[model samples]
Target: MIVVNLDVMMAKRKISLTELADRVGLTPANLSIFKTGKARAVRFSTLERICRELDCQPSDLLEYRPDEVPQNV
Candidate 1:
């Protein structure tokens, strides 16, 4: 399962969800979905905006952790 590090990043930057949404020109509801990692897709432009506003790299916003694959019995 993919996990969002938004809470962690926000803590590190001391930025609130509303703050991030305001900076990124997105609605708090939309940003909240992204923040919670419930988003199925993200636009490149949006990603760029987010990175710029957050002063962070894409990798900072996202991470990959390989989970154990289920094996057939």
Candidate 2:
């Protein structure tokens, strides 16, 4: 599974959602989806823009996490 650490990066950079959206040329609603990990897919161009604005790499924003099984199940 992939995890998005957009909120973490945004906090570290002291950037608001509106500010980042404006800088990245994306709508706040769209960026919110990405920030919240609700996005099903993201374009490379978009990722590049975000990384450029955040001054970070894709690896900083994305993480590979193995899915955890439900112990109760």
Candidate 3:
């Protein structure tokens, strides 16, 4: 499964949701959805802006975790 590591990245950058939203020119509501990992899709331009603001790469914000089948679980 794909996972967003927004929380970790934000923590590492010590940025607040409001500040990040302001920096990215995104509404707080939109940022909140992303921060909470509820977003199903993200725009490339948005991602680039975020990476630029956060000093991170897209790889830093996203991760791929192999699903453990029910049997493994």
TM-score of each: 0.80, 0.90, 0.85
Superpose all Cα atoms of candidate 2 onto the true structure and report the RMSD in Å to 1 decimal.
Answer: 4.1
lDDT, candidates in the order shown: 0.79, 0.91, 0.86
**Which structure among the candidates has the greatest TM-score?**
2
lDDT of 1 at 59: 85
Query: In model 3, what is the error at residue 22, expressed in angstroms?
Result: 0.5
Better of 2 and 3 by lDDT: 2
* Cα TM-score of candidate 3: 0.85
lDDT of 3 by residue, 1-73 (tens): 5677987998999998899999999998999887766777899999999999999999999887796322221
Clashing pairs in 1: none
Using lDDT, give the best candidate's number.
2
Models ranked on TM-score: 2, 3, 1
lDDT of each residue in 15-34, candidate 2, tens digit only: 99999999999999999988
- For model 3, what is the C-alpha lDDT against the true structure? 0.86
What does the lDDT read for residue 62 in candidate 3? Answer: 86
Off by over 4 Å in 3: 68-73
Error of 3 at 53 (Å): 0.4
Looking at model 3, the pairs that clash are none
